[model samples]
Target: MNFERAIIIREKTRLEQLIERFNSKAQAKFYIERSGGDFNFYEIENEKFYESLNEVQKSISKHLKLKIIYRSFLPTYIFTENDLIVVLGQDGLVANTAKYVNGFPILGVNPDTERYDGILLKHTPSDMNNLIKEVVKGVFETKKVTMAKAELNDGQTLLAFNDFYIGADSHISSRYEIEFKGKKEKQSSSGIIVSTGAGSTGWLSSIFNMSHNIYGFNTIGENEHQSQINWEDEKLIFVVREPFLSKVTQTDIGFGVITKRQTLKIESNMPRKGIIFSDGIESDFLNFNSGSKVEIGIAEEKANLII
Candidate 1:
């Protein structure tokens, strides 16, 4: 067993964040309970998460060099080729880490299953040790998850594990020219959602559900929505959110599927406030104001998840 290192990625607990913002846990509890929230549940959830992370850390350190990293520091932290990543948080944390990493095999752990769905997290602290042993012995299996990519004309690029949002920063409509499968149209919409196969069951599912309710579009059945996606599928899906019809702007090209051979392109028409962000992280984004053109498609790189 010759693994170089293992990097454990964890997000700050709500309790820790409360202390950071309000200067103490007592103040945070007072504020939450006063506002009719469950402050007791918060404390219990935080304690379970910390204990799970601690146990996982101790087990990994016995076999390989262990490094603990916070989710906030992922962008600046350098990853090595031999590093095995173990994410201890929600499903979104795994998705967030997938974009920044190259091909490191990741083990997703749900520290507190009560607070999370753990759809992407297939392991618990009790089982993490055995998985690490298998990984180090080169006997673990992995699934390759497809990712979405957005590239601007000027060469800046962003990758998304779940989906990408192309629109304004605020509630204002986003104005852009949409081109897909050779047909193009000018549109003013709430935004555009570009999703990978792995993300089809998430944000993309909500958009389709809305369409079904509004237009009686039941082409996608309740069970089939998730059936359409495979983690390793090399394709992409996009839907325009609430496109408005104008005399000049059209709504014919509001939704479509993108593939390796096919792509979706958008040219920004808003003078200001236009932005393109991925994986729900709005703080880190690319300007998509007037004159900016972006191409959305399947990313060349894929995320590997240890099973």
Candidate 2:
């Protein structure tokens, strides 16, 4: 594909957010210091982020037209196949941007090497010039990442690069009727998490860790082992969080694998406050209340990350 421009996606720094809330840099600093926080850290972080962003702009602009957009504007941004996505921030920013890209090639750049793990950021600012050239020439390589989808009966839908959380918005139990492989059960639990292969080591692995320690055994044997689901895997894993067992609710159908052949179906039993959020972004969610039903499955679209 011939690329015409690069769209840089970014998020506001912590200091910037503080300034917005307190109305000024001085006020933000005073509020943080008064609370016994290190105000200097926020300033330094903001400085480094912009410094890296400047480097990225200088390099990529040499090959294509450049435009910068904040994360808040992603939902309404008009993206085309001719645009290359350049995400510069923490790794979560990459996940946050993937669903909106519609399979466009995304180059993840890690701005703060000291602060972020950069699990999805494979390139640094120095690599931008060469990488942009390759992308424009259609010679760049991309790692295909699978995603999960939640489609509501009302025609609304949500996508997740890592995982999807279906449950209540608060700490209260989520009541839902779940069906898989033709078996059905009513469940009352913390919620349900449907994770893609790229997210296996994230929130999903933590659950396995807690279970293995509590049970004193692993899936294979007494020796511990962490399961790995590849980024390209077509399957999904769903685990119920703290399912409650009683006369009306059961915990038997708490865990399973979801595939193209077998999709997971759910119906909300809660009167209100039920939600379905993706990639840990609560603001971007679908209402899942009573009389609402959803189908969970592997998404037809995948995140194409430029590796």
Which candidate has the top score in TM-score?
2
The clash numbers for all candidates, in the given order, read: 0, 0
Name the top lDDT candidate.
2
Residue pairs in clash, model 2: none
- Relative to the true structure, how large is the alpha-carbon lDDT of every model? 0.88, 0.93
Which ten contiguous residues of candidate 1 have the minimum total lDDT? 219-228
The CA-based lDDT of model 1 is what?
0.88
Off by over 4 Å in 1: 217-227
Candidate 1's residue-wise lDDT over 27-120, tens digit each? 9999999999999887898889989988999889877899999998988888877888999999999999998888778889989877789989
RMSD of 1: 1.9
Stretches off by above 4 angstroms in model 2 are 218-225
* Cα TM-score per model: 0.95, 0.97
lDDT of 2 by residue, 1-307 (tens): 9888899999999999999999999999999999999999999999999999999999988999989999999999989999989999998899989999999889999998999999999999988878887788898789999999999999999999989999999999999999999999999999999999888889888888878887767344743445558999999999999999999999999889899889999999999999999988999899999999999999999999999
